[model samples]
Target: MGALMLKEIRSFLNSITGYLVIVVYLLINSFLLWMFPGVFNILEGSYASIDSLFLVSPWVFMFLIPAITMRMFADEKKAGTMELLLTRPVTDMQIVLSKFSAGFILVLFSILPTLIYYVSVYQLGNPVGNIDNGGAFGSYIGLLFLGASYVSIGVFASSLTENQIVAFLIGVFLCLFMYIGFEQMSELNLFGNADLFILSMGISEHYTSMSRGVLDSRDMLYFISLIVFFSLATRLVIQSRKW
Candidate 1:
């Protein structure tokens, strides 16, 4: 399992995929927060808050993470190596987890550099370091959880198709729906008294809670459960070949 995980990470690093993910992620964020002339630009907002980064990052991850994980299993099957991989001593769950871990690590790499934005915001504050450290820290944690959940979803999508494009589309659709669809549905009052319940089912609700600097157990549990659910689903997809 460890070897498989390392191999997956090494594959990402050896190719342009790893660098591309990190570079593009940082570039987009930097542009939105600095260079871009819009509400996302910190200078235009004239507020020493990195709220725009948190606001825009989820949408960015919706596409970027899928691209990162699109070829995890899809490329394996495409190259006819999936059979060889299955025949290895590792369990299907291990295989799924290895890919998921590699993708999540790549996501982390993309996120770490964004800390510079935080530092910049901190210093830009009137009193220097007057920024809301608690909220900023919480938002970073929320991003980690959000990224992990997207990775799991992407891994599952990849396991379902040998075509990387199809996997990428599926991953993006699923991530978008999970992140916002439930909240949008609730706004329609379709569930009546159950509207709040329905709204709570989406990632947006929990993510919002965390963004407010509150680490609720339920929010943490929701993210963990979402990740586990998709990981298991991917494992099952991998195991289906046996049947």
Candidate 2:
């Protein structure tokens, strides 16, 4: 499992495509938080917090993670290497997890550099560290889980298709739907006072709760469940190749 995971990581880092994904993610977020002259600009915002980073990152990740994982299983199947991989002495679950971990780590790499934003905000605070450290920390954690969930979804989408473009499109659609579509539906009064319950089924409600520094276990569990569900779904897809 570890070897498979390492290979997946190497496949990304040793290639231009991986570097492009990381660079593009950083460039866009950096421009929005630091360079752009608008509401997203930290310096122009009313408060000296990194709220803009948190606000913009989720949307950016919706597209970025799909790009990273689009070729995970899709390329393997496209090049006809998936059969060789499956014949190896590893369970379907391990293969699924290895790919998921590699993709999740790539997301983490994209996010880690943003700590600079946190430090810059800290210093730029009213009294030089007067910012809400707890909230910022919580939001970072929320972002990590959110990205992990997206990775799982991306892996599942890749497993379902041999075409990278199709995988990418499916990933983006699923992530966008789970992140916002459910919440929007719940707001239409369609559930008849079960609106909050329906909204809770989506990622936005829990993500919003955690971003506020609340750190509820329910939110954490929701993310974990989503990751597990998608990972298992990927494993099942891989297993289906045997039949």
Residue 211 of candidate 2: its Cα lDDT?
86
Task: Give per-residue CA lDDT, model 2, range 64-105, as digits (tens).
Answer: 999999999999999999999999999899899999999998
lDDT of 1 by residue, 1-243 (tens): 889888988998999877888898899999999998998999887668998998999999999999999999999999999999999998899899899998999899899999999999898889999888999999899999999999999999999999999999999999999999999999998788999999998999999999887889999999999999999999899889889
lDDT of model 1 at position 95: 91
Which 10-residue window in model 1 sums to the lowest lDDT? 39-48
Q: What is residue 187's positional error in candidate 2, in angstroms?
A: 1.7
TM-score of 1: 0.97
TM-score of each: 0.97, 0.97
